[model samples]
Target: MYFTFLGTGAGVPAKLRNTASMVLTMPEYQGDAWMFDCGEATQHQILHTSVKLSKIKKIFITHLHGDHIYGLPGVLGSRSFQGGDDQLTVFGPKGIKDFIEMSLSISSTYLKYPLEIIEIDEDGVIYEDKYFKVSAKELEHGITCYGYRIEEKDQPGTLLVDRLKAEGIMPGPIYREFKEKAAVTLPNGRTLNSSDYIGPDKKGRKIAVLGDTRICQAAVDLAEGVDVLIHESTFSHGMEEKAYDYFHSTSSQAAQTAKAANAAALILTHISSRFQEDDHLLLEEAREIFSPVYLAKDFWTYKID
Candidate 1:
């Protein structure tokens, strides 16, 4: 799995950043990519990267803020023209449905694919399949916002072909039967247990992506033990007062949240345009509290380990 930042700026587009958007690529893990947010000109940003709009199966909106959703109508309409006819589901806060419906209705934009909008009002598992489970929780933001926790299901253990070969078992249809059943009877009347021929199960990775918010416990709950934590750092250190007054967070606050949750790595995004020329200041501040912190730039990609 991996992540591609489409727009890393906050509020408006800057010379180096756009707004707020992210694409989590999970082709090998889940066979498709999922978008975390779709900020202004996000569709335009996708054009500069390897992201495939057709492969975006689901979109999780953090809030109804314009910077986080202005490109939805354009992206949806373009997806249809690009031959993306598969179903696309969107999960967001209440009123997201109205905003999308009204925008599309007013602009006369149409999508050729089926669209599913799920408005969330509580915290719980919002989406689940055999491969992954997605949960959301409310965060302290200017408006009602959410953070998502993506937990991948544990994968089956590796089949020990070397062990079978040691027992004189050659590559044949029996290998297929061995994987499908717990125990299999060989042609020679011998019985084999699949458990004995399988390695330990590999635990799946966890990722937490939080929308714009101040330091809050809900953020900790959603980010606990996550492999990666994507948080907003709209300000620099020593600006905690201003950060809290505006319901945003500083680099130090973001780092504290990651440190508290024991996140393996922290990615800071939604950078304020005020730091347009000094984003390194924010990056440096976060590193003081949490090592391996990254300041997301537009089109930057991060591999999820």
Candidate 2:
């Protein structure tokens, strides 16, 4: 799976940035992409990228802020207009269902596809399947906002084909049975334990995407030990007072959360329009506290190994 940032701006769109929108593509894992926060002009941004609207299987909205959800109506309409008939599920806060219904109703739009809107009320495992599991936690925001934790299931390790071959075991359908079970009896009445010929179990990756909020322990809980932590840094350093008043976070505070949570990587997004010309300041400030920190830009792609 991989992540792509469609827009990384704060409240308003600037010349260099648009707003908050991202895609977590898992073609091999889920056969589609999962979107996070479809901000204003998000569809326009997708036009410049390789993302397909039909490949969108799920959408997660962090909050009901205009900047984070204004593009929902357009995106939903366009997805149907583009001949997308696949099932789509949206997970968001309590009022998200009303917002989507009202927008579609006011515009008189019809969808060819089945849409499932889930309004999250409590925090727990919101979604789970054979390959992945998703959980959410409430965070500190002006409104009821949430952060999501997406964890991929652990994969089986590689099979030691060479070791088995050395032991007079030939590669065939029997190898499949050996890989699934601890023992396999050969035609000659010999048995083998799969564990002795298997490598270590490959751990899966974890990702955390948080909404607009001040520094809080909930954010830390959402991002604890995650491989990738996507947090918002709406202001630069030395702007803690302004950040607090606006219910946002500074670069330093974001880095602190990442550091405290022990995240492997921190990506700071939702940049303010004031720093349109000097966005590097935000990255530089965040890196001072967290060595593996990053500042997201529009259309930038982050690969998760």
Candidate 1: RMSD over Cα atoms?
1.2
Question: Against the true structure, what is each candidate's TM-score?
Answer: 0.97, 0.96
| Per-model lDDT | 0.93, 0.93
Model 1 lDDT tens row, 192-237: 8889988888899999999999999999999999999999999889
For model 1, the stretches where C-alpha displacement exceeds 4 angstroms are 29-31
State model 1's lDDT: 0.93
Question: For model 2, how many clashes?
Answer: 0
lDDT of 2 at 150: 95
Candidate 2 Cα outliers beyond 4 Å, as residue runs: none
Instruction: Give the Cα-based TM-score of candidate 1 against the true structure.
Output: 0.97
Cα lDDT for residue 18, candidate 2? 95
